[model samples]
Target: MRARNKPWADDYLKEHDEVVVQAPFDNKNKWQDFFGNDQPIHVEIGTGKGQFIVGMAEQFPEVNFIGIEVAKSIIVSAVQKSLDSGQKNIRLINVNAEDLRDLFGENEIDKIYLNFSDPWPKSRHEKRRLTYHTFLEQYQHVLKHDGEIVFKTDNRGLFEYSLVSFSKFGMELDEVLLDLHAYEDPKNVMTEYEEKFSAKGQSIHRCRAHFPHRN
Candidate 1:
């Protein structure tokens, strides 16, 4: 289901530009300065509503969390949630994934998260998938050496396709979980989409992939 448009979304974002950036490119390499600390930075590409990012911030207060979402309405909600959570370590950007390289400098990010992303099942639309090779290349460029991508989804087809994409790109999987809910990991944070799917007996697939180390 698509998210309904919120009439107040724009005003909401303007009011909270501190949490959701109005011009993320301006902060490109100054992310640590934005957070007022030099802590490790973690990003979530498709941050639907900031649940996972806020939870992670609460758990790991030592890291800074940045969430990027394209939908204005959705990102507005995320900004509100982050503010309500009172986690000073959280920040959000309303921008598409394609703008990633333009927003962060090389080796700037320590880790990235992709939770319950769109599968984009059609073959012709494969390039639109977040795990596409081009997207992985951008990820590698921005991610620090040894940084990892943590992905989760209920779509089996996307999961399988992503696994192949990762391997083909010469990336290696550090961990793979066929049934994330069953794995019962204490550190795993569930997005709203994941909780809904898991309640319907869906098996959540998750993996940690990393680009090869520099020579």
Candidate 2:
């Protein structure tokens, strides 16, 4: 579903330029310097409303969190959340994650989170899925040789397909949970979508995968 247009989104973004990084592309290859820390950077693609990223920032202050949200309506809320958290380890980028390499340098990103991404169930639209082979390759371009992709979804079909896709790419499946909440892992940060849907008894599927070492 498309996000409802927020008329004031543009104004809000401009007002909070500090949190809503205005020129993310220019920061490519320089994210660590931007953070002014040697701590690892973790990225959340399709970050909706900022819940997961903000929560993670607070939980793991040792890590830097970058959220890439495409919807202007949604990113504004993320920016506000970061401000409220009073955490300096978080940054928001109002842009699509279609081509991560454009915003990150090779071997720059340490980890990526694909939280409740669109399932894109139709076979014809498989390539559009965030976990699609094409998308995985794009991730490889920017992630370190040992970097990991953490994917979560409520759609069973997409979960199954992604698991197979990861294997086909020779990516190691470090972890796979058919019913994530059943584990009740303390480290799992809930996205707004995950909270709403899981409340209705929708099981969340999750996995951690690593690309083949390019070295």
Candidate 3:
């Protein structure tokens, strides 16, 4: 876990307390109560340093944002950002992505964001990658029938692999950008890792995969 060395981190730590959930592992229907709203909910699985989620929350007040991160120290900064920004629409949960089904009910989430997730380049670690078929299956369980997963990554290999995986799962892909920065589309929001990686001449890859319904 990296230390929150940024100036905003201290303020975040002072302002927000840890969120207390009754049973994040066994309960799958309590997520709706956490947001306290009927509006569409979007989740970011690895909210590193919280920049993207916080920015999105500020940008769209009507939509609710939930950030889940395995690192407590990182989540502390994320929660603090919500507090300092006075953003009631955003929430942070310190939990693993593998347990997402335990915290969210079936067809509960509207959208999912996988921003700069670990590529897990090794063949043996493919299952751990967020875009892997196994993890996508988990996401499918919690995501609404028409929900979509928006993914952005700098790793071309992972992006290509993910695209194949989504197709194999019978999902639809949209807004597929092989070179995101080169794309003129306007809905782009760069995460903390995106800014760092893209600045070094790395080509960012992006795609949106729609959940499939069984006939």
Candidate 4:
């Protein structure tokens, strides 16, 4: 679903002067300086409406969170959510995921969260899927040696495809849960879509993928 364009989104983002990061941000490798601390950096790509990342920032104050979204209209809502929550450990980026490597340096990001991402369920658009090999390669550049990507989705097709893609990229699947809500993870936070789908009795699929080398 396309978000209605809020003509004032850009103005609102600028005026709030909070988590919205104006790219291309300077001090790529010095992200800790931006947060004014040496905390580990975790990022959420396609952070729709910001529930998951914002909640994570609140849950884990020790980690800095960056929420990246391409749509200004949608991201504006995310920024507003962040403001409403009054969380200082998080930031937002209005940019394409393809440019993440430029925004962050190698080994700069400690972990990544992919929640309820677009399945892009078309044969011709396979490359556009976030779990595609092309996108995975970009993620690897910014992630630390032991960095992990935790993914969740309600779509089985996308989940299966992501599992294959991660394995093909030589990433180790440390955890896999076909029914995330059934699992006993008190720390598991839910995204907007995750809550919606789960309420409808849909089983959430989840997994954690990481490179083998810890160094």
For candidate 3, lDDT tens digit of each residue in 1-215? 36654556445544553432324555367566656767788988898778899889888888888888876567676775666788778877666756577778888889999998888999999888888878888899889888989999999999999999999988898779989889855757789889998899899999998976845
The residue-by-residue lDDT of candidate 2 on 105-206, one tens digit each, is 999999999998888878899889888888888898899988999999999998999999999988999999999999999888899999998999999999
Return the TM-score for candidate 1, rounded to 2 decimals.
0.97
Among residues 3 or more apart in sequence or in different chains, the pairs in candidate 3 whose N, CA or C atoms overlap within 3 Å are none
Question: What are the per-residue Cα lDDT tens digits for candidate 1 across 4-103?
Answer: 9899988888898678878889887888988888999999999998888989999999999999999987887788789889888888888775857899
lDDT by residue (104-185, candidate 4, tens digit) is: 9988999999989899999999998999998898789889998999999999999999999999999999999999889958
Give the clashing pairs for model 2. Answer: none
Error of 3 at 182 (Å): 1.8
Better of 2 and 4 by TM-score: 2
Show where candidate 1 strays beyond 4 Å: none
Candidate 4: residue pairs that collide: none
Model 2 residue runs over 4 Å out of place are none
Q: The CA-based lDDT of model 2 is what?
A: 0.92
Clashes of each: 0, 0, 0, 0
Candidates sorted by lDDT, descending order?
2, 1, 4, 3
Worst 10 residues of 4 by lDDT: 16-25
Highest lDDT scorer: 2
